[model samples]
Target: MASPLDRGGLPGHRVSVSPLDTAAAARHVATTEDGQRLSLAEQVAQVPTDPGCYLWKDASGEVIYVGKAKNLRARMKQYVQLTDDREKIPLMMQLVASFDYIVVDNEHEALVLERNLIGQYHPYFNVDYKDDKSYPYIAVTHGDVFPAIKYTREKHKPKTRYYGPYTDARAARETIDTIRKVTPICSATCAEWKRVRRLLDKRPDDAGIIGLICAQKGRPCFDYHVGRGPGVCAGMISPEEYAVNVRRVERFLSGHRSELTRELKEDMSEAAAELDFERAGRIKRRLDVVDGLDDRQQVVFPTSVDIDLIGFYREETIAGACVFAVREGRTVRTCEFIVDKGLDVAEDELVAGFVKRYYDETADIPAEVDVAVDLEDADVIGQWLSAKRGRKCTVHRPQRGEKRHLLETCERNARHALMRYMMRTGYADDRTNQALLQLESALALDGPPMRIECFDISTLHGRFTVASMVVFTDGRPDKSQYRRFKIRTELDEANDFASMSEVLGRRYAPERMADERFGSRPDLLVVDGGKPQLTAAMRQLEQLGLDIPVCGLAKADEEVFVPWDDTPVVLPSGSASLYLMKQVRDESHRFAITFHRELRDRAMTVSVLDEVEGVGPTRKRAIMRHFGSMKRLRAATVDEIAAVKGIPAAVAQAVYDTLRA
Candidate 1:
């Protein structure tokens, strides 16, 4: 809420107007307090003609929208003159009580600052590119002495390598399993190595320690006995030898098949020359596996080719974007994104926004990027990318060639992805339209509720309480707008009414109303309970001075409760309106339960370890990493628990006693 002059180092100005007077003010005329009429052109003429970012705020001083422009004055003039023909502009202007701008040095600076401000404020009117599902990745813990290759959806760990954010999660998991089968790193072996390595680092010439460790021949895992793993646990494979296998797995996942195959063949030859027939046979098997994988990959270009292709397909306000990551002439990975374009932006602007956001998160930046649409600021974006990659990067729009054909293929894939999403959500169906109309008549509202938000509360024995807000637009669920809340109020028992009131109060608060993630105000509000919940919701809205329509749907009989009527309105069992209501309610319940369960699981994991006198987060993590899971930890003996790195014998005994108790 700081004044424009107080924000950053940029010189700017603020314009204020009354919300009630916005209709007349939309004509580009404003009446000052002294009764002087100032035309919008005159007002815009005073703004600096520099590239910058602008912010529009509602009456409560919350930022509702943020945008960047090459010329600040021209952009302001377009808004004032009502020449910006975006569908949402008129509605957004009506809510605009004031506006401000921050001038930047260049177009690229404007773009960067605009993105940062939008992320910080989450302005509602900005285009939000959100993925409904988290794609899976194959992660390798390269920081460890004996790296563990695993399938993961999250990439939070530092000093680790992640590859293939595959759209097909099952395929990613299968790949990880196959790699583990080819190059197995035993967990027991890793634990022992960590322990010995720590001791050796502190005492270099401890012969007694080395001799004692070397004297014990540890039992090998099942994979080692089955010939699928190197016998690291059985002392047959040294740490240096185990690291070679880890490097091979990393190379395989990184799409370096040619180099890895050559190296493996050389290793096999050396093993054969040394008369190690068993080792040579193992290397030969690995080489065949690598060759088989290489043959399966589809090659679209020469071996030296490395580039990324981006294509998009937009229908109405929703767009699906496809990214093809080509490495060493083959398609190594593919990524898909669903974008909600709140405004009717130009195709080139859409492409620019998508490129910036995508590359910002991705670690691998190709030297060349080909897009379906031609961008005006391609050079600026390329410069930004080059700085990020520490090398020269180029952005291009392929006209006619094999690259164009591949780009077209990527666009086709994007279209198919959009179609799949449409089919799954039943978006814009005739039945959905009929349902909206029916609901409007049944609820006695002004018009069909195009945007509906439903709330549900979930808790288990008064623990890990949570709430979910699910949004439905045009009778189709909009997962991007969905939000979860962890209830902060302390409660001795389950209280749905109080929980509903608290969630509604928090959601409708002035600050939350302007957040981009919350989206626009819902046409109607639905609560998952009976009359009491409906009353609670209505009361909260009334306290906040909000006039959104409120209703409650009871699960017992599917009865809908409205404030004016004492009797519950129950639509026909097979009616479309009833079905839509049930869908929204069920989705809210599912979302809330999922969030609650995640909290409960995480708390259980931490709480069990927290009860031990000497165990903290570090030692707890060590215990979990050593044993893999709580089930195995519980089954482990005291001596086994004490063997984990960083876990002292006294602390391990305390942890064992706590779990046993």
Candidate 2:
């Protein structure tokens, strides 16, 4: 007995098609070179003694590495003369056939160009993320009246400021959670906060109403009694006051650890002077969080100065960077980045290259940077960092002192990270390779399912139709290749069949085969359903005159459906092959759910506003700010609405009429 969703029917599926893919396509990255072969030494001889970025091409003349230099000649010399300092140097030099350099106005320009080229080329030797969204940002949705500090991915959105392309998503979230202990900001979506806000604002004096709403919200959200919220939803804190709290969070995350604490202390004293006990206590708690962390920082200097101590280590199989974020004379946090260079690259170049990638991806950069590696073009790197920070920056290898000791500590950390990376990669490879092999044998495919793609559609009662395409490369999430869609179909009824058809059709459409999302066809395509869904996917591939293995993982009894078979192929329960299938299916479901929630939340806020002719975003903000709540504006007399600063009498009357209707 199979449930409807797990069987031949798809009663709860949809096509999520969005016009937003156009914006994503605009950021499409590709290599700039024509794969021209040139002599390495000859090209190096032509390089000027000026600041610039250089690209090293393999024998095939494809860029394997990108590096920047203060003096092009001095930096290029390091590559030609191999050093035992790096194990990869000999290997890289063997492959070096030709190279090119982009002359820039300054070291700053060179650094910027290096980043751009790496993003475009994704050189094998550069520290690059497999997926764009791999780094998570603690995003403040300042675009909304009630901003929330939450985990958000960066894709350059408007009105929202992002912090840290934090290398570790868990660490980023942990930092935010710790911040909430001192200055509580809303973690809810704008619509959710707005609903609670309206209720509390309209009944400002009603303590009972606040209790009822907060209780209904349960333990997970906005507990004013526990002070997990700044009392915003209950109208206990003014919007202006909440903005100040959010600013503190921004400053803390922006690497202003010492400066932010001083401000918090001053603000606490002011609150105490005014006899605002609660406000003073809240500020004190924030001070405690800043002062009380187990930072493991040895007091190197009595006076505080911002610095980032960096070190790198390379093993036969793996290489890594250890970055100690020293703020106000203390090491506040440590970040480690490790990657397997496809081609052998020298350790010195790797350190320089990693530094560029890290600072470019993250918002936090220090005024003074100390490195264990010589970094040949330290002055150029410092100049570029200075420009980025709108202040002076110094990048240098430390002489004997506390700075040298810190670099030693950073190097030790890098060694530990290298060991961990080696262990993890070996274990991960065994599990993933075994799973892929098992999956291949079970499916009887042409080869291992190294790159498997799963598609799942999500919608709420035919609203905000959306779909997710999740990619797993080598049996690990390749988030960079993940694609999202908002489907457009004129259906009087919800149809999983049609939704699957539309999403699959658009994905494999002849024009899309050359597109990055579709150009690299998956080794295996797994749809989230049974016979009908499997057929819908196969039909699309057939229409496109393509032949790729397709299957469906029906939720009912964990049955799998292949095009050639009428009956399902149910893998052994709890088997590794089946677990791999379930993992992909679940991931697609989760990705689709998040997109669906975002769309629904957006509609809850914008649909009503969109209907009001006189109320664009500007006018609407004024109205919300003026009345404090939409409930108030709905009940307001025309004169009260007209009295709002930005609204004319005619506009106010129109707004009043619209709300009344």
Maximum-TM-score candidate: 1
Which structure among the candidates has the greatest lDDT? 1
lDDT of each: 0.77, 0.72
> Against the correct fold, how does model 1 do in TM-score?
0.52
Candidate 2 TM-score, C-alpha based:
0.48
**Model 1 ranges off by over 4 Å:** 1-91, 97-123, 130-132, 142-147, 155-158, 181-251, 430-661
- lDDT per residue (tens digit) for residues 1-661 in model 2: 1222223222343211111113331132111146443345544554578777777777776888787778887788788866434544555677876566655556666677778778767887676632334667778877755577778775646567777666687888898888778677887553446676566567766534554455555233445666667765555655677788888887777656676778888999999999999989888887887777635455656677788888877643346668888777766677776755312455567677777877765556688888876877677778878877789888878889888987888888887876786577574466568778888877778899988989999977787889999999889889998999998986666677788889988887778878875538889999999888898888878888889899999897678898777878866543457767888999999999999998886676566666877788998888878877656767899999889888888888787777777
Would you give me the overall lDDT of model 1? Answer: 0.77
lDDT of 2 at 623: 81
lDDT (0-100) at residue 415 of candidate 2? 77
RMSD of each: 27.1, 31.7
